[model samples]
Target: MVKSKSIYSCVECGGRVLKWQGQCPHCHLWNTLVEAVAEKNSTRFNYTNEISRVQNIEKIKIGEEPRYSTGIAELDRVLGGGLVDGGVILLGGDPGIGKSTLLLQALCYSSCDRAVLYVSGEESASQIALRAKRLSLATKKVHLLTEIQLDRIQEVLGKEKPNVAVIDSIQTIYSESLQSAPGSVAQVRECAAQLTRIAKASGICIILVGHVTKEGTLAGPRVLEHMVDTVLYFEGDAQSSFRLIRAIKNRFGAVNELGVFAMTEKGLREVSNPSALFLSHHEEKVPGSCVMVTQEGTRPLLVEVQALVDKSQALNPRRLSVGLENNRLAMLLAVLHRHVGIACFDQDVFVNAVGGVRITEPGADLAVLLAIVSSLKNKPLPIKIITFGEIGLAGEVRPVQRGQERLKEAAKLGFVQAIIPKANKPKHSVFGIEIILVDRLEDAVTAIF
Candidate 1:
């Protein structure tokens, strides 16, 4: 039998080292190494100890995996219809960001055909019940357990056999087999793996809540993400009442799916019109404002892109961005200077995606570029205009996917005009929207100005 040993792990990158050092040799993150006790391997894999037989491809049978509805349409959309049996989901967010409320509300309102267990290592039964009361949630089918020990939770799982189990957080749960404290790398990994095993062995679906670090990542080893079937992160500003649940990874559904919620006095209310919520309110469309339609998973969302260009008085012009990338902004400025006649070489540039929503797709490139130009020239584009396309280094406007869907969304939102790449011209003409196909950045500037 292998003996237990102590090992050092880098908290930043989850790299392991046999000995401690001032800095991690792999990730170069300083003062992030912590020691943890590693348990001996109780199960070994080798050719000499083979047990289960492998079946041939022709003899194997396939069937659709079963799923249960959480009774929330927005949640079901993000989850790809419903939660699958024997699947594990990890949800992480900032403190007081409504992670617990969302999960509890789902459990409380879900169709109670099966037993539901909520094992909380962070909050007690009373605390959860009080919050549920405040949220106006009531349920008798849900069972609550306040525990952190892995063995006790496993015992409950075997006895109750709930169709779905929710662990409040994986960081606070620990296994007795390891000497490491809860929230450590070893403990988090072990707890997650054991929970996953229990979920798969039985038909119970497991949802694990995770605490996020100051760096905005899950507070555990990176391997914890890989061991789960789905990973979701909550995004919203602390000052704002809006919340967005985004799926980073999903095995059974489409990834990058988004669910929008509004925090009210009672609880979270699903937003029926996400585009209106994510748009900046203004009586008139301003010079620095532009509209763009970007696809989030299977849904096409319209968002406002804003930009400000001012003459710099400081040594280095400030290049700041929110809900967008800084490096991409710099590249777009360079492209505008090189291709379009507009120049912002010595100006401080700031770009933002309004309403705390992030636009990652390249289709928003044209809208951002147009907004910057509009700000620089002190001119506003048409109020009923929407634009989306990819910008190349050579100043050519590139086509984006699902062009018709984008145009249709814009039209539905009352947009009448659109600027898109020439290559993305639709096969059939849209009824309400007038599409202006542009081949070069210079042509777009000319059309807008």
Candidate 2:
């Protein structure tokens, strides 16, 4: 009989310690160590009897992996052309963020031709059925399994041999071998490792839904993300109907890919043209409003940048930003004071990207600065004008990647003029837009004002 012993494991790093401590010694994080049970003599294989073979790198043959479409074009785009055989995808999001709804819709649509299974450890069969019926999805061929035991789930997967399977939230699944509670660090890590091994060995595409921490990162040990083939995050506001899925890691496709969807009474509906969703239309051009183009993976997106400047009565003025980095905003304000002769030291400044969509790329730097200046001066930028470029500390306008693609997208959306870095100016002018090339911050201000 194997003996069980108590061990302390760090939730952030998955490092084990013999005793408990306030801070995890491995990761140096406070209060992340949790108690778990481990069984002695758990190893089933003898390393002394195992033999390994090595082959030449040139002798290995490569072939294209088969992909199964989820029947949603936007999701297909984010997954890098659909789900690959034996690939494991990890999807994380906030509660009620439509993670399960999107997957359910996809499985229903995909059930037309492929064998798909939805294993629910979180929801009951009737709960899932009610959601499907509410969404008016065709679920005749879709298979449902309500189980949480790791061994039983693996047994069902082997017996059913479905091409695709979804474990609706890995946090709820537990293994009898490990005497840890479900959703614990040890349980999550062990269950994910076993499921990934099964997917690879059986050529099954598995999707694991993960819970996010209060900080919006995936919960559980960090190794859980490393074990998966792809990592996707669902982002949006609860008040808003729009949701965005972003790919942070992918082995078969590109990372940072984005898929846009809208939540309706029925279910999640893919937004064919996501650019329109991020742009706000007004009766007239307003001060502190500017349009900019940003590149998300392979697609170019147009988003509006808005700013407001007000007199501050407080000793220290407040600097706030939404949908854009706050630290970058402060740096940009300093640049404006040092280079552009505009100061916001005594004013309260706020900046926001028009939609809930977060902008990470520095391509929106130029547009953000321009919007701030416009707001301070109480002047409106010209209508149908777009701008995008990176700004350096020395006030130089740096070129961004895919400049031509951004310009073309802006033009296609009826933008009449573009203020871009001199290096980003196209070799041949776009048919409908006039390009204003600026080499420095002063040049941009002069051209715009």
Candidate 3:
């Protein structure tokens, strides 16, 4: 008989120690170590007798992996065309962010030709059925399993041999070999490893749902993400109806791909044209508002950037930004003061990206500065004008990636004029649109005002 021993593991890096500590020594993260049981090795010489051989690289066969559509065009786009055979996807989001709803719809639609299984460790079969009925999805061909044990789930997968399967959540599943409770660092790592091995061995496409921490990151050992084939994050405000799914990591496809969806009473519906969702239709041109083009993966997106600057009453002015970086706003304001002679030293600045979408790239810097200057001067930018560029501390306007694509997207969306970086100037002009190239921040300010 093998004996089990207690050990401490770090949730962030999956490093094990003999005792618990306030901080994880391996990852240097504070308060992440949790107690878990270590599996004993009973047979030291139990090795595989099968011999392994190495083959020449040129002789290896190369073929494209087969893919299956999820019935949702947006979802398919994020997954790099469709669900690849033997691929494991990790989907994480806040509570009630429609992660399960999206998978349920896809599984039902895929049930038409492929064998699909829906495993729910958190909810019962009747609850899943209730949600299916609410969404008006046909569930006759979909198989439902409500189990949390690793052994039982593996048993079902082996018996059913499903082409596609979804583990509603990876945190709830616990292994009998580990004495630790479910959701612990050890249990999550073990369960995820087993599921991944099963998927690869049986060619079953498995999607694992994950929980997010308070800081809006996936809650588990960091190794969980590295072990999977793809990692997707579902982001949107609870109050807002619009939701955005972004791929953070993909082994078979492009990263940073985005999928837009709108939540309705029926279910989550894909937004074919996501650019329109981030733009506001005002009766007239408004001050402090500017349109900017951003690239999400291969798709070009047009979003509205808005800013407000007001005189501050206190000694320290507050600088707040939503859907954009706060620190970058301060940097842009300083550049505006140094280069353009526009000072907002005692002004409270608030910047926002229209709609619920967040802009992480620096391409929005120029548009943000323009919006701030427009609000300060109380002058509306010319109607149907768009802008996108990066601003440096030296007041230089830096070019962004795929400038031609951005311009084409803006022109297609009926924008008549674009103020872009001089370096991004295209060889041929886009039809129905005029481009104003600027080399410095002062030139951009002068051209717009």
Off by over 4 Å in 1: 1-5, 10-15, 21-32, 38-51
Candidate 3's TM-score reads 0.96
The CA lDDT of each predicted structure is: 0.88, 0.92, 0.93
Query: Which 10-residue window in model 3 sums to the lowest lDDT?
Result: 41-50
In TM-score terms, candidate 1 sits at 0.93
lDDT tens per residue, model 2, 1-449 = 96668899888788889999999999899998888886454852223223668989899898887787999999999999999989999999999999999999999999998899999999999999999999999999999999999989988998999989999999999988877799988889989998998888889999999999999999999999999999999998999999999999999999999999999999999998899998998998899999999999999999999999999999999999999999999999999899988999999999999888899999999999999999999999999999999999999999999999998999999999999999997987898999999999989988888
Q: Candidate 1: which pairs clash? A: none
Pick the winner on TM-score between candidates 1 and 2.
2
The residue-level lDDT of candidate 2 at 390 comes to 94
The parts of candidate 3 lying over 4 Å away from their true place are: 1-5, 42-52
Report the alpha-carbon TM-score of model 2 versus the true structure.
0.96
Which scores higher on lDDT, 2 or 3?
3
TM-score of each: 0.93, 0.96, 0.96
lDDT string for model 3 (1-449, tens) is 76768898887889989988998889899998877787665431222235558999999999998888999999999999999989999999999999999999999999999999999999998999999999999999999999999999998999999999999899999988777789988789989998998888779999999999999999989999999999999998889999999999999899999999999999999998899999999999889999999999989999999999899999999999999999999899999999999999999999999988889999999999999999999999999999999999999999999999999999999999999999999978899999999999999999988
